[model samples]
Target: MADGAVSINMSAEECAIQALADRVMSQIADLFFAQHITPTPVQQQMLVSHVRAMALRSRTGEPLPEVEEALFEDISPDSMTLAQQVVDLFGNLPVEEAWLLSVHFEVAKNEG
Candidate 1:
């Protein structure tokens, strides 16, 4: 786990989920670095938290609350593409997952 990562009680399965989330976040950090998108510490923390939840959802087949597509109309195509790529890492997530995740990337890019 990265420095400052959340500490939680975990069963064996939850530990695996945390490991998966850590791997995915490492890839995402590399992607952000390659793109010169530096999220602030707070933003990075939020992203990590969100990805942890995403990892659990991926493992459990949980669905996201419905997100309105129009809310993301202002998101850049690049952000959407990147978000979709992240969502694809989980293999079975819905498009709405991408849509929801894109907000984090979009915010980080804009605020970077």
Candidate 2:
């Protein structure tokens, strides 16, 4: 027998949760783009940089520290309240959707 570890695939429920997380992150990105608050190139770059970082971190086993940090940084005079509203509006989605939303929040936290 080989010494390598065996790999086990995720269940259907796990897959759904992963997909949902992606959707939530995409939704947050869409919301930010729609608001047009990112007026400068630097700002856009910042957002994208954060998103990428978050995505990479997700692949690893990092906790939600990045998420919290991003939220705190991004919650400014113009967009903070809107972000809060968006969170409230979509907070109580179903389990799958909620998972997606959590993913988005994680991404957003990293991005901000």
Best by lDDT: 1
Tens-digit per-residue lDDT, 1-112, candidate 2 = 2878787788875565556556645766577677643334554555445444444334443444323345354334344454444445434422222232343344444454
RMSD of 2: 9.2
**lDDT tens per residue, model 1, 1-112:** 6787897777998898999899999999988998899999999999999899999999998888878899899999999999999999989888888888898999999997
- Go through the candidates in order and give each one's C-alpha lDDT: 0.91, 0.46
Backbone clashes for every candidate come to 0, 4
Give residue 34's lDDT in candidate 2 (0 to 100): 71
Best by TM-score: 1
Give me the overall lDDT of model 1: 0.91
Which pairs of residues clash in candidate 2, taking residues 3 or more apart in a chain or in different chains? 20-100, 21-100, 25-104, 70-109
Indicate the TM-score of model 2: 0.38
RMSD, every candidate, angstroms? 5.1, 9.2
Lowest summed lDDT window (length 10), candidate 2: 93-102
